[model samples]
Target chain A: MPGPGEFELIREYFTSRFQTGSRSGTADNGVELGIGDDCALLLPPAGKRLATSVDTLVADVHFPAGGDPYRIASRALRVNLSDLAAMNAEPLWFTLALTLPHSDPAWLEPFARGLAETAHEFGITLVGGDTTKGPLSITIQVTGACARPLRRDGASAGDIIYVSNQLGAAAAALPVVLGEVTVSPRQQQQAETAYYAPEPQFAVARAVEGYASAALDISDGLLADLGHICDASQLGAELNLDQLPVAVLAHSLQADAAVETALTGGDDYQLCFTVPARHRDAVQALQLPITPIGHLSEEPGIRCQWHGKPWQPRGTGYQHF
Target chain B: MPGPGEFELIREYFTSRFQTGSRSGTADNGVELGIGDDCALLLPPAGKRLATSVDTLVADVHFPAGGDPYRIASRALRVNLSDLAAMNAEPLWFTLALTLPHSDPAWLEPFARGLAETAHEFGITLVGGDTTKGPLSITIQVTGACARPLRRDGASAGDIIYVSNQLGAAAAALPVVLGEVTVSPRQQQQAETAYYAPEPQFAVARAVEGYASAALDISDGLLADLGHICDASQLGAELNLDQLPVAVLAHSLQADAAVETALTGGDDYQLCFTVPARHRDAVQALQLPITPIGHLSEEPGIRCQWHGKPWQPRGTGYQHF
Candidate 1:
């Protein structure tokens, strides 16, 4: 008998039947050549700079092994799409390099399904990639187009900082996944949904396009990620403790614990961005769920304030070492 | 104390010191934004389709775990560069999604050195990607430019099939690497060199440009790779068994073993391209060790012949199960 081959596996699980995003809407059929070739060809929209990024997810490191393969697949694709969102780029296409120990259709069917669903939802077309024999790992590369690319170093000292949504739900879900804590089924489902299918803030990114100066998706907790923006923009941030959008499920923890999680909870795929003081009223008038959590300043390091007084902190969540 | 953190590690080892492949030479400075950004930006040359390919290399699957980190890094970058060569595209920039058990400078310095060396040699710049904790694997995504991109589906009946160099040296080197065989010091070095670093046929690809109808680099063995071309082009191939360019190390094996190894052995990293009858003279005139081992035909599958007698093959090559 023939080997359980690469092409056969791709054809069985990763082809047109598994296509997620609808190509008819906004995506131009930019795929000149796709799978079954030496390399895939893509036509970048005329006169637009191409924005490309890559992210890899490994079992037991990024997620628990033996977890829901469908959700795992979705997290991998969406996080990379989050990078496209961070750049304020219109989503174009993606390629996935998947390495697995075995070609079990049981795992692949739902995995491919989730991948397709996320792709279609994000309007991302699958271009090409390679699958090979190895430990369970996925590396997703996404490319998009942008004219006025928002960068992380463009924030001025007087800019106001904002985050798109509430924080810490995914980080709060980890204890439930590890069975260290119990939650009501509804809360568990909510946390798991946040953990598995991260909203990449693509719509929020578009809404803030020219108005936002420096931006990044909050992946490494609010503190560490804002520290990143501070490092890039050569400025610091001052956060008002009372203004943070704390998630409902995290509120179940001790008061201090809940506030800590909200402040430093990683895996919140919300946009953290800055707008100059001159544009504050204009940005606030947009009337989106944009929260004014902090302000960029000429200070040297993060200064957290509680009830208008200096508040000391412990650690930011999920520092990848 | 701070964690042996991701951003710190990147700043210490993977910064400008690791920039390889001079943009001043043949490589145009296509990088509009690079390593520090959310997504690196590139201005693709006008009227050119962007050719993108991704390849992942895993330790103990693609290479031994404890081998030299530098050589392993070089191999990972080069094999992906081979894909760009196959498509006959000019190198632009690449993003690397690298996973590691931990960040150790001893391993990373040499690894970054090797990565930079190969990047400079290929004239490709490092763009944006993520580093996370996981089993060690490297996924490289390369994008290049080509006006008339070479593909596998354009071969015609009566087209001549050519390969860039001798085959099976890397596959032949496997046993030596695994301690299954012994050879002279010189022979061991020769085999190891081929195994650790397979040369991509970039110059040969340039020579055959606009003349070759369909092209691919032989990562899988000659028979298997040619079969891929035939499958894509909806044609068959007739190869002269005696005409196979078996490398000296592989040639040293027994008659049947040598033939089987030459036919089925993989990791050759040689170019297999098809040229129309009309452009045969133009292609051959370039004269860079061009070898006519076969011809595309109207049949449906690959047919190997020796001295006008049909040869029954053992198997095509390594099939990734």
Candidate 2:
């Protein structure tokens, strides 16, 4: 009961927090005409269709309790945006369901600021949401639009697989949770930044819109996500571990640690996509830091080559069950 | 951890739960291809735009902790579907976010069955969702489609207000939580059924589409829901309690109790709409057993008369904060 009432909390933390993007006309403003009404009305662009995705993050399961609300809001919203990015969609509106143990304005202010900053960055507006008192959890359902979305089933055999940015920031940030390694003042800044605030690959997603075959953002790690593409396209893949865009493990604790982090660690909000081999040059010409990690194959099982030896997944990657 | 892992539990309970209504197409369809994917994909019909709404039900906050999961699923999903119905949209797909203290197959089986039944009845496909280990909560986000959705702002001052079904089954069912009233085998069956299984006014919504000025389904109490319409239209209302569709409450409880429940109980899942005064007969001919509870006024405040005297909300109907 210490928290703001659901209506006031939504008004203070969500409704009054962000500005609508330029694309949303003044009539269809950031605060849609229908927010406080029964259901919010969204006007998608004329030629485009709507794309939607929902994700829920629970305390202890998704984030540590007592973590900064600012970071939690950032991470929670960003992950959903990453999903939109996977489909090469432009985020238009989002609905949040925030459940908290108690309402605390002190905590809410920073949280709202974080959410607003991210919403502004993504050009998305917070349209409407439900707030309730309960254990700490955030469920975000984002609606985006795509002229032609890059889907998992769109990949064909022999398409080259590419990944944006480096992997394992979130996995490496896990040490901050366990207290196994004390983050230095600067590293704490770096690790916490990466742990809490994942940069959604929207720019890269937009850049690859017309070029990529099948695309999805990396949340459950590279191998697991590639497995999704395989299952969807009914194809196999051969990953070159040597070509994986991960930081050098030797620079940190153990040599193989980075591999484990890149393989099974979750919460890396990077883009994993497959493009036909013919478009490799066109994709590369975008001058983005993308690494070809694998290739889709005619066969039907995931295989990897590490240190010139065949490699199989040692454990299933990031099982929520 | 005693509950089944997220994957196995989802596979066992949710993967094959609902039949995909869109299976005539080539897309790999099983209730929208859920569970083994990064994000669920739902394909709506070509001409329809998706209308989405989200609602969260918390333990002790929304429903009691040890309550039946079947009812939880039914009520949770129905409330969300009710939002879509309010928009005069046809139900299409829904995503669920289930947070539980433990994974109990006993709880999930009935819950999934309830969700499947509702989805089948409404022609909605269960697209995707997250299952996390945490405090008990259920967050459902449902999407439907419509060519033209009814807006609250469309209501004019002279419109006659109407509501389908009677109100207060959820309120009458509250005694089961307080243990004040002993529930008989039959009463228990009815009360529990009412508490959990709310029949969304989908047929009524489709029948009254284009006939109603502005519409919404009552999940909050009658006064509270009508308040939304009033707030949106910038108008007031005068309710003649004598003409209210109070049969459901009248048949179930004592006179005063029925009146109280009819006014203040939540979770009716019935449509509350407005129709222009001139078109009232045409609206009435839809013959959905609707009652002319009130009339929208040029003035700007809500007023109700009970037994020829003024009546106001005795207490806050239901507060999530």
The candidate that achieves the highest DockQ relative to the unseen native structure: 1
Candidate 1 lDDT for residue B77: 84
* lDDT tens digits, residue span A1-321, model 1: 434577789888886554332222223448877777778887889988788888888887788778898999899988989888988998888999999988888888999999988888888888888898888998999889987777888898989999987887778777776567887898778868878888898888888886998999888788988888899878999999789888776776435587788778887788899999888888888888779998999987999998889987788757788
Q: Write the per-residue lDDT of candidate 1 for residues B29-103, one digit (tens) a residue.
A: 567667877788778888888888998888888888787888888988888889999998888888888888888
- Ten residues in a row with the worst lDDT in model 1 chain A? A18-27
Angstrom error at residue A177, model 1: 3.3
DockQ of each: 0.75, 0.48
Q: What is the lDDT of residue A277 in candidate 2?
A: 94
C-alpha lDDT (0 to 100) for residue A271 of candidate 1: 86
Q: Which CAPRI level is candidate 2?
A: acceptable
User: Per-residue alpha-carbon lDDT of model 2 for B1-321, expressed as tens digits?
Assistant: 377777678778887774342313334322333444445544446655557678899988888877777777887888888888888877767788888878888989999998888777777777777788788899998777677776676788989998887777767877764456775677767777677777777778788776788888887788877877887788999998877766453346445677667776887777899989988888778788678888999898789897899987585456666
Q: In model 1 chain B, which range of ten residues has the least summed lDDT?
A: B19-28
Instruction: Give lDDT: candidate 2, residue A313.
Output: 66
